[model samples]
Every structure is written in structure tokens, then in C-alpha cells.
Target: DAGITQSPRHKVTETGTPVTLRCHQTENHRYMYWYRQDPGHGLRLIHYSYGVKDTDKGEVSDGYSVSRSKTEDFLLTLESATSSQTSVYFCAISESSRSGNTGELFFGEGSRLTVL
Candidate 1:
């Protein structure tokens, strides 16, 4: 096992509501990322952290934020959610390889957030 799991496998909320999704990992790795996936589009990065207490925003970072004060946990928060954000959210971790990233990431099943 890659030692990763996302919480609230399923979530339902109304538009404009505040939502928080949790990502937990036990890989003891240095990189963690949060992404959203929707139809007709590839995985879009929302936010990511390079190490404990070290984080940065990503391409589609609007309406979202993240926190990582511990090595095994990362959290994503939607200040005011929207229907556009009602997509499947995934947490992934990259293992350092002498061979480079290899674009390989171990992902948690996913957290499906539905905003009505």
C-alpha cells in the first residue's frame, strides 16, 4: 500500500457553503498535492506542499487554499464553494526517484464533493 487515504469519500453541499476536505498519508514522503478532476479535462492542480509547513498555490488555485503543518496530513479548504468546484478531489504523493518524478503519483481513491 502507498499509505494514503482521503476523508469523506462522498460529500454533498449547497453552493456558497464552506467545505473542507482532508488528505492523509503515511508514506513519509516530502511532496503532497491536491487536485480536482472533471469530465473533458485532465487533472488540474489546486494546491501542493513541498514539505511540512511549506506550501504553494497551483494553476487552478482560485477559491481554494491548503495547509500542511505535519508530514502525514494535508488539508484543502474552499472558502465559499461553488458548483464549478463540485468535482472529484484527489490527494497524491510523489516519491523521489533517482530516475526523477516519472510522473508517477500514488493517489487516494478520491473525495467526491457535490454542490447543489
Candidate 2:
């Protein structure tokens, strides 16, 4: 949703390999976030950026890196893939309201990554 598009919707990789999932948005929202969804963990934040090149680490940021060079692109990179990192990753875009982070996010379908 929100004019977001995730690339490599499904991927299977070996442990220790490197992988990158891309999220592109057409809405030009002011904020973008990376979240992972697991069976028991639900949705957890991985990283988020409020503006281009301005990013902050999230709760589950370890072993992952994100880059936002433009308002329309957000890239999530896994330096070394691991089995524990297997999950559905989502990209969300939102605009800050007068009250700040309205907590209303529009998410992309999701990118499923599995590490063997």
C-alpha cells in the first residue's frame, strides 16, 4: 500500500551470504521505516529514517543496515544472512502530523527472506 514497492518479493539464500532488499515509494512521504514480522514476534522495527541520510537504529537493527538516499528509496541490507533473520520484512511510509508520528503507517506487501 501507499505506493510502495518491495523488490525480490521472495528470496532463499545460504547462511553467511549477503542480501539486500529494496523498498521504493512513490508517495514521497517524510518518514520511512523497516520492520520485520515473525510468527511470535509480530512486527518489530529494524530501522527508520526521517529524511534523506538521516537515520536511526531501531530495536532489531543488529546485523542490518539501511540507507535512504532519496525520498523515494529505502534500502535494507543484511551483511551476513543468518537463519535467525528469516522473516517477512515490510517497508512503511508515513507523514508526520501536527502531533508527530501519527502512528498511522501504510505498508508495502512484504519481502520474504529465508536463510538456509
Query: Could you report the Cα RMSD, in angstroms, for every candidate shown?
Result: 1.4, 1.0
Pairs that clash in candidate 1: none
Over 22-113, each residue of candidate 2 has an lDDT whose tens digit, in order, gives 99999989899999999989999999999999999999999999999999999999999999999999999998878888878999999999
Q: Estimated TM-score per prediction? A: 0.93, 0.96
Q: Model 1: per-residue lDDT, tens digit, 1-116?
A: 79999998999999999999999998888889999999988799999998899999989999999999899999999999999999999999986678766667899999999999
Q: Using alpha carbons, what is the TM-score of model 1?
A: 0.93
Candidate 2 lDDT (Cα, 0 to 1): 0.95
Candidate 1 Cα RMSD after full superposition onto the native fold (Å): 1.4
Superposition error at 78 for model 2 (Å): 0.2
Instruction: List the pairs of residues colliding in candidate 2.
Output: none
Q: Against the unseen true structure, what C-alpha lDDT does each candidate score?
A: 0.92, 0.95
**How many residue pairs clash in all the candidates, one count each?**
0, 0
